[model samples]
Target: MNPIRDIVILCNNRMAFPAIQTLHSLGRLHTIGLPAENEDVKAFCSVFAAKAGVNLIVMEKLKLNIHLQEIVRINTLKCVFTMTFPWKIPEEIIEKNPNVFYNFHYGLLPEMRGADPVFESIRKQKHESGISVHAIEKEIDKGKIILKKTLPLRTDFTHGMLCTHLSYLASYILPELFTLLHLNDKGVQQDETLAQYYKKPTITDVSIKWEHQNSKSIQALVNACNPWNKGAYTQWNGINIRVLEVSQIQTATEQAKTPGTVLEINENNGLIIQCYDNTLLRINTVYTDEGFMSGHKLLAFGLKNGEQFASI
Candidate 1:
């Protein structure tokens, strides 16, 4: 029988909860909870710490050398794992340990390498996205991949939905990953030529460019930003309007309408606007600073036919 390996997990998200529980149940898992700025993450950590038979240590730093030193002094440390950790581990720790430190990334590495890969994938309308298990290196998300599991990227998946799905995927994959690590498997190196890094999307990045993009692209942007950052934003009569949901409408007529022009508003359709390619995009839901409002409510707020949305 393979000997039980002593593993340390460093994470701060609810996504890590299931994996934490599974590891703890195995009776060889040690966890370090980082102080999280997100309330949901903090709550998960609190609940995990409260559970019986779980060895958890709370720390304020991500360098993890001091924490590891203390663990090594008291117990035999086998490997380290990270899930949705905000900070990077120091180079010395990885250099000393070699392939022992692993990180679970939400993106298919060498393609989407940085923060918010799910959102980036959705915005780009990629056909597939997946989880990657990799050996932690000095560089952020540039580690060699140990394993990858792909899932179809659904057209309707919003930022929140995609994140929830990925978290579940991580939980499902953790046990298999632990087994591989215990057997001393070194992962495959990533190709530098195929690597593409994406930064966290800014408010500007999520803003809709109605004149430059087609209806499908605009809808993709709205779906990508929903339930995470404010959905793709625009302005109507000088009031900031966040587009929460949208759908494209195929039109047979070749009537040319200016991009952002309100082409139709009715009881059946709510609000439909023309896009760059003269395609129609129907606004399903919108949000103002006041709160969530449907497209019909927008009409009541003095939105009229032929009025154009303010462009960035």
Candidate 2:
């Protein structure tokens, strides 16, 4: 049986706890990260450290070099297995020492290969998505697949839930992946040409565009933004309503109402709005900073039928 020795973890806090627990179960020793000056990075490290316990070491980008020197100065082993440490670690430490470094990404390579895979997946309405463990390079998320697993894109999913599910899948695959690594089986190369890339979504991207948007597309937008940032929105009688829920409305009206026009406000049903291609969007709920209220209340605000929501 191959014995596991030293392993380093580098990933977002969402995946950290599971990574630590899974690696420990496989008999590999690991350390958690520390807070850095970058607020997002610092918060991620802090939460991860709190969950991972005292072994956590907080280091700035500069301190990482010093820490690595000490690790090399004191330790005999030349190689280390890392998850998502931010520094550009030296190749000498990896190539010469035979250190194995692996990282996990939320999307399948040659497909949704970028920062916000779940949001992109929902936008595209892909039936399936994936979780991948791969060797990290200087470039982000491009590497040979150490392990991969397909997961369904459930309609009810939010970004947080999708991330959590992917983390779990990655955790389950880690033990097997390590076994493969210990057996001297490095993963194969990925086809660079087939890789797809996506940039992080901005506030403008999150705003709901009622124009040219169909019922299905609006539903995707709603699902993509939910339980996080309520995406792409417009004013309904000056009330800043965050669209939290939507669905396709079956109606007999063939008349082309203007896009974003409120067609009907049924207290028992929901607010039906005109969309592109004469399709209708039924808004189930709207959220304010205060809280979400019924779609009926939106109708009571004098946004009567035939009122348009075209962007100003």
Candidate 3:
């Protein structure tokens, strides 16, 4: 029987929890959970770290070189794994110790690379998105592929749901990855021609374009921004409204109501708005200054049937 290799996991996201558990059970795990600026994130990390039996090394920034040096000085680090860690190690170190570092990306590489790929995929209405495990080099997500698993991108999947699914998938596949490493396998290189990168989603990206975007596009935006972002939003009667959940409804009413116009309100169906493509959008949930509420409550909160949602 082959001996288990000593591995270090560097992570900041909650999605790494399952994989962390798997690594801990393997009994050769050392973990570094980075400090988050958000108070909620800090609390979550504290809870998860306690359960995982990990003493997190909380740092303000992800200076990989400094962390690696300290880790090597203290322990015999044989391999490193990363998930949602914001920084990359220098190429010289990777060259000196080839195949020692690996990263799990949330998107199928060569197609979608960089931060917020899952959001980008949903925003673009992609039919499929996947996870990739690859060698970590100097260039971000341009490394050689070790193994990959593709999954369908369901139309109704929220950002949180997709992330949870991918994280669980990562936990399932990690053992196979370790076995491959034990056999000294070098991964396949990625094709640069097919590569595209996406930056993190901003407030502007999450804002709804009710006047210009089709119902399907708007629905996609709403699904893509949840749990991680402020969500696709609009203004209503001078109050900012974040649309947390929405569904597209096919309408046969060829009446050309202007986009953003409130077409109807029903006790069960909620606020129905006419979109740019003349299709109806049924909002299910929304966030206001007070808190989250169901769409039907918006009518009682001053949203009228004839009033329009402000594009800005």
Candidate 4:
């Protein structure tokens, strides 16, 4: 068997680009999947398309069943790899190479552990989000820190933008981290007290919570649900419309209208609707099953005043 030298990468294409580039720079590379693996193989007939490099092995699908054995074999040598959200890396792997394995996570570890981490961060409207490289342990995201970089959370940042920024950070940090690991440097331990846990989101979790939610809460909810999933929605005129953008009107002349009531519709001002706590939300965009439409045009299309939206 060939003695594996330097990194093996286990990540999707966009996120893996930096790792692949790093290997290319170091002249040692290996990968689990390639971009073309998803399509029908006959479509990629070119010689350039089908070739696999020594460092770039493309597996058709990732099977957890063989992962532990494969990782054990790889780690026995001096080889290192990059993994994000590993499905199955037995603790035996960690016990064998205690401080070698590392993965990048979007949120501060233990605080946001699970799928949809970017979404959870946006829901809380945190001022800062982080890209963390931690030692891979049996527990979820509860590993020792190798490197972590925090950045300001922009007001307009969606889940997509947040992921892009985090992935960029990972790409920048991983190679340097690998160099350190190669030198036998063990990273710092994480404070278990500071760690928190989050769960994978579900359809119910994405449903809009109309009652007991303020305008800011609603806005946070809207921002958190995009990229992979649509924003929390409600039925308007028997049609589902995902709330895309909303702005609170704090200087309204009076609070005479009930929450969810139509306050006004202007040719330029868009649709103004009452929020739960007497606040006004100027809805700018919404996604209907038929496609997206403006709240202003939705009302202009004859959706009546005082018509209720069904949101649990």
RMSD of each: 2.3, 3.7, 2.4, 4.3
Candidate 2 regions with alpha-carbon error over 4 angstroms: 1-5, 37-54, 61-64, 67-99, 237-239
Which clashing pairs does model 4 show? 29-55, 30-55, 110-196, 111-196
Q: TM-scores for all candidates?
A: 0.92, 0.82, 0.91, 0.81
Error of 3 at 37 (Å): 4.1
Better of 1 and 3 by TM-score: 1
Across 1-312, the per-residue lDDT of candidate 1 in tens digits comes to: 643547777787666767777767666576555654567776676676677445566665653668756655446577777888877787876776676678888889889988888889999999888899998887899887888989899998898888788888877887787777768778889999999999988877899998898998998999999977668899888889999999889983378778999987877878989898878889989888888978767877789889999766
TM-score of 1: 0.92
Number of backbone-clashing residue pairs for each candidate, in the order shown: 0, 8, 0, 4
Worst 10 residues of 4 by lDDT: 40-49
Clashes of 1: 0
What lDDT would candidate 2 get against the real structure? Answer: 0.68
TM-score of 4: 0.81
Give per-residue CA lDDT, model 3, range 31-135, as digits (tens). Answer: 555645645546766776688666666655656567666655545567878888776677877887776788899989979997988899889899988889999
- The 10-residue segment of model 1 with minimum total lDDT is 28-37
Global lDDT of each candidate: 0.80, 0.68, 0.81, 0.64
Ranking by lDDT: 3, 1, 2, 4
